[model samples]
Target: RKPGFTLGAGILPFTHADYIGEVRESGLSYLSAIKNATQYRQISDDITLNAYAAYIFGLIDLAFPDGRPVGFWFNQIKQALYLIDSGLDPQIIANVIEVQMLKEYGVEPNWRGCVIDGRADLPLDFSESYGGLLCQNHWDKDPHRLHASPRAIFYLRRFSTLDLNKVERINVKLDTKAELRRILDVIYTDMVGVTPKAKRFLDQMHQWQDRLPDDSE
Candidate 1:
């Protein structure tokens, strides 16, 4: 999500029902609640992954307000909604969205090779401060560089270029998902400098989900 946009939930009263009707016809409306003099209504479509839909909508609201033109992001946003609607893992979908957000800001981390020496064969570490990967030879530059494993790096590269519509479901390991989350968190902090409330809530939700007992057990 973009910096400087703070998101929260509340009701906005629209005294005029006609205005709400126009807003819905613009093809830019998200799920919202409506209340009129006569009745109350919740305006929402049938969503498969309800929690994921909420989280994704929250993230969008955190960045873009009403009537904001998401020019370049239109397609990506649609793709994310489609993927999540089809029941893709929310964590990976979140990762993909975050990566694309970084690209939109032109600050996405470099994963191609070592930022300094361009040595693809060497072990690489992701550096949020430098905004790229750093090889062991240059690890001295940032003492806090992520001791990134090859698998983490591989997925980062993959997500960086992922086309949500073209891909099928990818079941990422828990450990890999954690690593990716950590890496993205650091980069988002360093670059965007704001932790969205929606993202924080999403993280908390994941933690609670992790504590649940598996049915197979």
Candidate 2:
């Protein structure tokens, strides 16, 4: 919904093209392409938004191979971008998207219930190695299970099923956010085995935000 030229990339026909070491801007301008794509209506070039966009793109790279689409996640990705643009809590949005990506990649944690007993009522901890939540009865399954608090598990389950379009804003405690971050880190490292460079950049940006002086002061 903004007017101005912005940086973007799109799938284009390159079948009959040859002269290429690195395609230049002149070539891009010469190609006939559609303008004012509806998908980009809500997107803007602000740095914070761009950071989240990059992170989302990085996740997409990890989730799918080049030149392919995963139909299941198409709308989920749209929802994430919209939520990112809507100024919701970005950490929570990232966490939600990561969980969805895990589901798409077939390693999603057992947020619905304990992996062993299927008891959804009991207190649970996250098991990175065992690949799901473990109640006290089955904690022995993974010697290094993550001790997730009830609050953390609650939000994890909620975020896993969250409808981003319905949320305007959210308030997450710093401790809860930290727990979510740590848990996702272990899950991604253990199961996915790759970290996107954009995630590292986003982490540094978050650290910078944390170190900044309070504006209220």
Candidate 3:
């Protein structure tokens, strides 16, 4: 359904080569020389999609005013893979990545006050509709505000400038993590407008993963 230059240079940049081999049966392996690279074997669909998340992000970066940096894009890809390799949930990793990028590339949400008015003393509510966060008074005025946990907000602030090493150090409660995950899903869906294929895939994977007796993905 597409034409030449389909998925051009960096577009849909494949995170793994096996996916290509499996899809096209070309008998060519990117890792042919290093036949024993265990890191590339037995990857999960959720993980692959998580890695592909970077490509989606890269596409978004195309609109960056400064013209996206190649190193920045590569670093984001590495961050996603690193979190996955560290045994972190691909979903959470994606959220953290988005939170960080939302600040760096996207609008740094006014976590300090209301998007409509600068009321810096009240609690915050994340509003995807207007972007960034909301205040208690504003939250009262609008019913569509996404849930925002203080801890989640706290960690998101840190994620804006913190490396994965520092990110790993934050002691987040499980419930707070879950809340952050949901909040980010809403934020990303609204930010992108119409859920992205990568996100839809992640949601589908979550449905199945949550069904297991010991589900923990």
Candidate 4:
């Protein structure tokens, strides 16, 4: 999902009564709890996503199962501020924010780690940011090409602890007929410890293939 600001909304199955009872039972200060509940509702109204919306609605119902509807609303708002400040991604943030806004009645402005290595951390978020950054620098748009670039691989290898030997093994396993022969030749000459076993295996396989009946038709 993309990153941006918006109101909140939710889609869950819960009655106002269920929400109210939980509030009184929790023993929180009436004014503070009310504010939290309100914010939760507002944030729930603004954000968009099916799964989270349902969860927030369920949370609200559990929190205030018997209180007045207005009280439930206020409490949600207060909860939203806390959820938003907790570093949730945009889609989740939106659903959670609305639920909190409706329950609490206040808004909190705290969101971070939305970007990684100058790329948007979320799926679509990267499309815009990456595109803009690449265009500005006159770079290619294709991700495969970008990732294959030497500079890109260098940066990735610098940040990651990958196994080069394993990568070589995988490449050898998938090599074309000509490529496989070239790689096998190198292994026979340069590789140590496993060369004898590899050569024996290849020899046996080639002999087995030679014994198969020809199907020229």
> How many backbone clashes does every candidate have?
0, 1, 0, 92
Q: lDDT score, residue 215, model 1? A: 86
**Ranking of all candidate structures by their lDDT, best first:** 2, 1, 3, 4
Whole-model lDDT, model 2: 0.74
For model 2, how does the per-residue alpha-carbon lDDT over 1-217 read when each residue is reduced to its tens digit? 2344232333221111222234354555333443433443334556666677768778888778865767867677777777766677767888888887787677877788888889888788888876788888888888888888989988888888887778878899988998899888888888878788878887788789889998889
Tell me how far the alpha carbon of residue 130 in candidate 1 is from the true structure, in angstroms, after superposition: 1.4
Residue range 31-58, candidate 1, lDDT tens digits: 3443333111121233224445555555
TM-score of 3: 0.59
Candidate 1: RMSD over Cα atoms?
A: 9.3
Model-by-model lDDT, in order? Answer: 0.68, 0.74, 0.57, 0.31
> lDDT value for candidate 3?
0.57
Report the poorest 10 consecutive residues by lDDT, candidate 3: 31-40
Stretches of candidate 3 off by over 4 Å are 1-71, 103-108, 116-122, 169-171, 214-217
Q: How many Å off is the CA of 216 in candidate 3?
A: 12
Question: What are the per-residue Cα lDDT tens digits for candidate 4 across 1-217?
Answer: 2243111111122212223123356566332111122224433354322234444443444444555474644544333333433333323232233323321322121122122234323322111223212321223353521222333222222213332222211111211333323322332233211222323444455567668897884
Q: Model 1: residues >4 Å from true position, as ranges?
A: 1-48, 58-68, 213-217
> Largest lDDT belongs to which candidate?
2
lDDT for position 104 in model 4 = 38
Per-candidate TM equals 0.70, 0.77, 0.59, 0.18
Q: Tell how far residue 103 is off in model 3, in angstroms.
A: 6.0
lDDT of 4: 0.31
